[model samples]
Target: MRIESPPPSGIPGIGLRPIERSDRQAWFDYLRLPEVHEHTSWNVHQPEDLDPLFEIHESVSPTSPRRLAIVDLESGRLAGTIGFHTVSDLNRAAEIAYDLAPPYWGRRLATQLCRRVTDWSFETYGFVRVQATVLVGNERSARVLQNSGFAHEGLLRAFRMVRGRPGDFNVYSRLATDPAL
Candidate 1:
């Protein structure tokens, strides 16, 4: 594949740039929504607790391609964030986690954001697979993956220990070979 450059509009809906560090509070506000956070990689939110984790995004090595913040074009708000932290070069794969602010839910923002980043990853970095795990009850998160072309691969009983309890999980994956991709 030639991996053409991303659109001049810079990947459309998630196009708003530079992911202002000042938006950290807004990002924290998103986490406070139970609808948004129940399925999140981080399950709880408090004003003081978010800064350190938000810092992790900010601290990504400048040369490292593992992190990003995506903004909403219409509102210039931090729609959400997406990143790859557990990466395997040999397998050409990475695990991604992202979410749109609670108010942005159901607007197809998450799907657009996922596609924008995945396209960038595949075209820019040659990833063969992108994967995510959603808690079984989180219909919203599951829909985001499905709408973005990921398929449910498997289910694991008590697959993840989240918020201190064993919970069922659905593993969703989208391969570079996927027709929709």
Candidate 2:
């Protein structure tokens, strides 16, 4: 599965498009936000810290992570990013993750983003499962996954290192046979 070019995410009010070079600054800025970084595993202390992401997005392939920029339909500004990582062809599964700018929080855009990408991943790649790991305390993200039709699988105790210390994460998954709400 050599991902040459992905199509637009026909999600209403927002479009999920491939990440571009111009999006680097906006992504960097978003990652710098304390509210945004608090939930993610990456600790981006400087602008240069985002350079690797830019590099990966620049040379994306099917074997590489599929990163898409979630853009607002009205403003055309990047609301956030959502993507599938740790894709396993043998397992027909992948790990999904997303983050939005603080301004876009509580807009329900994250749910839509997750649905579009999850549907796309299953439809496009024949993936049987898509999983998301949300930090235990982040109820908002948990709700986003639930609203998107993902079921809470279980908890991975001290699964990820957030900021610096280890933290528990609630595992969530949506199977291809699951209902799309």
Candidate 3:
């Protein structure tokens, strides 16, 4: 399923929309940066690697793995992306993920992005649980989740591979019943 409109970010000069083909260059410029991918598990090594991500799938279900660009309204630049990594309608659950370019970091943009997407997932998809996994030691990301009302659930031992080696991750989650931040 393709998401046409992203929920309002509540941040001035920032907007969200489905990631498009036009964004591939800008997305790759930052996503492949060592500073940006160091804390996440993105495997992007070249621009072509992101092609699959931009394909618009036609489906009625809103649970498909898709990303929305966090854009700069004035310059029309790709500031970052936030979206669902996985969704399980049967379980009323989904995993959320996000990343911001180096230039856009440290502006509280991540917190707003996460909050808006989490709320949208609950309301739009009828999901009861929205979760996120931060590679261990990615304190900045963990803080974003915490500020967005995701409580740390626990640590998963060797949960994923980061930059080739197995890495642990800290799981966090926000439920529909949780008070909004």
Candidate 4:
């Protein structure tokens, strides 16, 4: 019952693919940026903090069958990454998450990528729902979900122990029956 990784989104100008070792530097560089993690899940990430992720990317295509490295095909660079995590096939649901290189922000790429991925999941896995949560102050992420057609759900007080401290979260989601982009 392995889920195949979703095909490239066919965004006309960009493609997202499973990450590769060659992408290590690009991803590392982006995560290393001080502003990338601001008001998000992590307080800060050292290059060493991502060692396991790089290892997994190099050695495995995880059961999740995800790890999309955003590519600006025109420039052929791995601008960032997005993936579905904590997926539960039996429940026909999954949590969607993503991040882009800071330089790639504000271009609507995040919204586009999220939409493409959600469409693929609903179509391929018959997923009844795709959900996302954001740190309350992460307006950008919330906007991505909204722009991609998700409905705002509610807030979770002290929702997660992010970077070792309790932090509030705002939930949002889109169902298979929701509007299409």
Candidate 5:
């Protein structure tokens, strides 16, 4: 099923959309930037590496992994991507992941996108909990999650492998019962 755009981000001219094949080139351009990849655990190295991620699917399954492109609605530029890395119906939970192009950094765009997506996830999926993880030293990303109302939980030792070696992560969560942002 096609998930409608969550809601207005209130960030004039910036919005979310389902990733399309046409976005592959722009997505590749941003994803390949060294600075963009340094903090996140994106494994993409070449354009072809992202083909699988952009493959068209007829409808979204409840547990299917999803990634939505963040676009500049007015300019039609692919600014970033964000969505759930994992979703679980039985657990009533999901994990959110997102990244922004360097040009868009320091603009509060990530925080706004994160807040809107988290609200949509809870409303659409009836999830009790939404969580995010950031590499230990990624202060910017951690701040994004916190500004989006996610409370820092704790650090997970070697929770994820970035590039190659195991990297420690800080986990954060926002629950349905939490005060609305």
Candidate 6:
């Protein structure tokens, strides 16, 4: 499938670009952060564990989850990543996930990134709904979704396994008809 590059989001001082091969080390380093895995399902026990993900990132398709590297425009630093996954053309829906380095946390960057990607997905994919699942204790991410106009759907019991333990997650969603934040 031919995947068209999304136009640069007009947000100032931040940009989203494709994750490149050269980013493998940086991406690995970010994922290695203990805080990054605290609320996420990612289980990166070792460096080699990320090989499969890197492979997937290398050959992304429209039907597959589109991963975009979030960069600091002025410094050109890899600040984080955001992506839409579980896309269903028939259902016109998808799920979103994101992570930022600890240095970028508490800055409302996640909210801006979520808003940009949500708009892009709805506009480019004609998705009627975009969903995001946040670990139950992750108030920050939940707030980011809500701030981005996503409504709380419900709790998903044992939704994911984080660090080998079953975890509950809160499901939030935004519809194309929802007012933009």
Each model's C-alpha lDDT?
A: 0.70, 0.82, 0.87, 0.78, 0.84, 0.82
Pull out the clashing pairs in model 6.
none
Q: Which regions of candidate 1 deviate over 4 angstroms? A: 1-20, 58-65
Output the lDDT of residue 179, model 6. 80
Give the clash count for model 4. Answer: 0
Clashes of 5: 2
Indicate the worst ten consecutive residues by lDDT in candidate 1.
Answer: 1-10
The better-scoring model by TM-score among 5 and 6 is: 5
- Write candidate 2's Cα lDDT for 1-181 as tens digits: 2244555666667777777768777888988877876767878877677777767655535556678888888998988888888888789899999989888898788887788779888999889999999988888999999999999999999898887799999999999999766
Report the C-alpha lDDT of model 5 over 86-119, residue by residue, as the tens digit: 7787898989988888889999999999999889
The TM-score values for the models, in the order shown, are: 0.79, 0.89, 0.94, 0.86, 0.93, 0.90
Model 3 residue runs over 4 Å out of place are: 56-62
Off by over 4 Å in 4: 1-5, 54-65
- Model 2 per-residue lDDT at 71: 87
- Write the number of the candidate with greater lDDT, choosing between 3 and 5: 3
Q: Candidate 2 regions off by >4 Å?
A: 1-12, 59-61
Query: Residue 61 in candidate 3 has what lDDT?
Result: 64
Give candidates' CA RMSD values in order: 4.3, 2.1, 1.5, 2.8, 1.7, 1.9
Which predicted model would earn the best lDDT? 3
Comparing 1 and 2 by TM-score, which wins?
Answer: 2
The per-candidate count of clashes, in order, stands at 0, 0, 0, 0, 2, 0
Candidate 6 runs further than 4 Å off: 1-3, 58-61
Q: Model 6 over residues 54-157: C-alpha lDDT tens digits? A: 56655546556677888888998888888877878789898999988888898898898899888988888899999999998888899999899999999999
Question: 84-175, model 1: which lDDT tens digit per residue?
Answer: 65677778888777767776677776777777777767777788999988888888888888988898999978987887888888998888
- Model 3 residue 151 lDDT score: 96
Which candidate leads the pack in TM-score? 3
